[model samples]
Target: MPESRRRKAAVQKKRAQENVEIEKNRELKGSPRWWAPLMVGLMLLGLIIVVTAYVTGGNYPIGFDNGNYNLFLGFGVMLVGFLMTMGWK
Candidate 1:
């Protein structure tokens, strides 16, 4: 191969690698639109559970009381997070 051709190929390869890295960084850098809310909701739910448990002295079956509701909420949040993470091109 010619010297110029080899140099061009190397530059192209480097550019491709840089593009891929940028894309990956864009993918991983943020919590995404829905992710932030989902994470915040989950965290708040955890906080509520902890506070309630401490206040009630573990007398109430908090987890059992709203088990399905919380599960559904989590599923919905997870679905949103998944969709957001996918990041449509």
Candidate 2:
């Protein structure tokens, strides 16, 4: 018939936690206008690097005499772009 003190406290605590989470989320305001473009650019640049390396035979653009290293370098650039996606909104 009536609410218990313990139950009310628990509900209040839960609500407080939920409110905090909501406020924190609101404060973020999301990513910047240029974020998506930059992220996509990095990813495409990485892909282009690998493709260029292949087309140029790893001797023109990224001169490394060693083809394998060029591949690694290209992949590394791609990885950076992929990693940036994690922070994307």
Task: Identify the candidate with maximal TM-score.
Answer: 2
lDDT of 1 at 70: 47
Query: How displaced is residue 36 in candidate 2, in Å?
Result: 0.9
The TM-score that candidate 1 achieves is 0.42
The parts of candidate 1 lying over 4 Å away from their true place are 1-31, 61-89
lDDT of each: 0.61, 0.84
Compared with the true structure, the alpha-carbon lDDT of candidate 1 equals: 0.61
Score every model by TM-score: 0.42, 0.71
Model 1, 1-89: lDDT tens per residue? 45788888999999999999999988777544676566556556655655555566554334555445544554555565456545433
Pairs that collide in candidate 1 are none
Model 1 collision count = 0
lDDT of 2 by residue, 2-82 (tens): 999999999999999999999998878887899888888888888888888888888745688787777787788889888
Instruction: List the lowest-lDDT window of 10 residues for candidate 1.
Output: 59-68
